[model samples]
Target: MLSLVDSGSGTVVGRAEGEDIVLDVHTSGSGPALVLLHGAEGREANDAFIAALAERFTVIAPSHPGFGLSPRPDWCDSVEDLAYLYLEWLERQDWHDTMLVGLQFGGWVAAEMAVRDCSRLGRLTLVDPVGIKVGGREDRDISDVFAISRSELDARHYADPAAGPGDLSQASRDDVLHIARNEEALALYGWEPYLHNPRLQRWLHRIHVPTLVTWGAQDGVVSPDYGRAYADAIPGARFELVGEAGHRAQIEQPDTLAKLIAEHSA
Candidate 1:
């Protein structure tokens, strides 16, 4: 069965294996499960939004392969590949009626998973997702985050510059290396499609589960319009905006975002 071990600290730690890949999974709280897919930066420990959600529902956050403590497997080189890996993991766990939440790149992965199958899955939430192109002509789609300086990128990611991961001058060597590694892994999975699956939009209609697409009202990475298009493509999907936040709502406005997620899933 699922070998989850509760550490008495309100968090449970475990590992899952599928397709020759292993995932370091962290879970907390006590009701239904909510699987959180981390963004390109990897997973965070004790994140505010995650803690908030833990109060009402069990939260399960897994680091994408090659992110955080998860090692990358050679066979996993695309977002689609990651999607399949996660699907296999979910099936292996025999989890049912679970809520799935994806943020940024994780959101893209979640979308892919839902499009493939919704069996045993309950609700879906995509936050500041970047998986489909919504730009035309002179307009730009998602911002080229890798193309900008770290400081500038942070500026666009948060409404308050100070709240961002400021200058890394004093950043620990390990922290610096971790950031580099995250970018490299992101490129491995998203470089070819440039962070989007060209055909995902067309396949979105296949998802018949309740879906919520949330965007930070001040998001500069992917505009609110792009988020709206994502919701519109999926029948009956609802799009909501979180104010005073940018790309990372969980970082800027965790509690509020958690409320939005909890209500939608409920």
Candidate 2:
């Protein structure tokens, strides 16, 4: 049985997927399925965004395999591996008409999955996604992107770094391990080409689903040029930018970001 925890203004339905994945899932409202994927430093806390997104669509927010209360398995290595795990998860849930929405690294993984096999996804929504690495644009690098203190990471990953999910003083050992595991996975998949496959970029045109690529005008993590590349790589993809918001524009500017997604998901 799953326990429901109140998030002050709302509730999060929590479920334990054994050692494989024990996560706090947030789902509210009702309609076609929308799966929310989180960035490296967050858990289902990203569900806060998903919950609001649920006002128009049925949301399914799951904590990553090794984040929050979820445990990392030995088999889970590459983003492709994780993507297949997600496919299996959807099958078990018996869900369909799915719109896969992901942020940061999660979004990049979603794109990878769609290009490889998009039989299940109805649409793809990626916000400030990171997959491809550009040449000669070495500002802050993904090689050490997640290799910093919690406070430093929070600042880098959020538009309003002050609104970090919560304080770190209260964080548990589990949380720390979870964070490290995600990096380990990133390192493994990102081995040679650094979390990106050039051929995968070539497959962007093969994605049949209507893809809406959104970015923040102030995204320091990735350049607008990279965003253009992403938009250009995918055939018929619509690209838009949210001003004043950083890498986490989806959370900082939910309504504006949500509007972009709804327009395409419609």
Task: Pick the TM-score winner.
Answer: 1
Q: What TM-score would candidate 1 get against the native?
A: 0.90
Task: Give the clashing residue pairs of candidate 1, or none.
Answer: none
Clashing pairs in 2: 190-195
lDDT of 2 by residue, 1-266 (tens): 12223344232222223433334565666888888887765554454576568788887776665554444456656777667777766766766668998887788778877877777888999888878655555643453564567666566666677755456557765655555565565566566566566567767888788888888786766766788788888888888888867787776777887777778788
In model 2, which regions exceed 4 Å deviation? 1-25, 92-94, 136-143, 147-152, 165-192
What are the per-residue Cα lDDT tens digits for candidate 1 across 1-266?
Answer: 12222233222222334334556677888788899998875675227778898998898888787776666666668888778777877887899878999998899999999999899689999999989987874566878887999888888888776767678887776666667777788888888668899899999998889999999899888889999999999989999999998887777888888899889977
Weakest lDDT window of 10 consecutive positions for candidate 1: 1-10
Badly placed stretches (over 4 Å) of model 1 are 1-19
Worst 10 residues of 2 by lDDT: 1-10
Candidate 2 residue-pair clash tally: 1
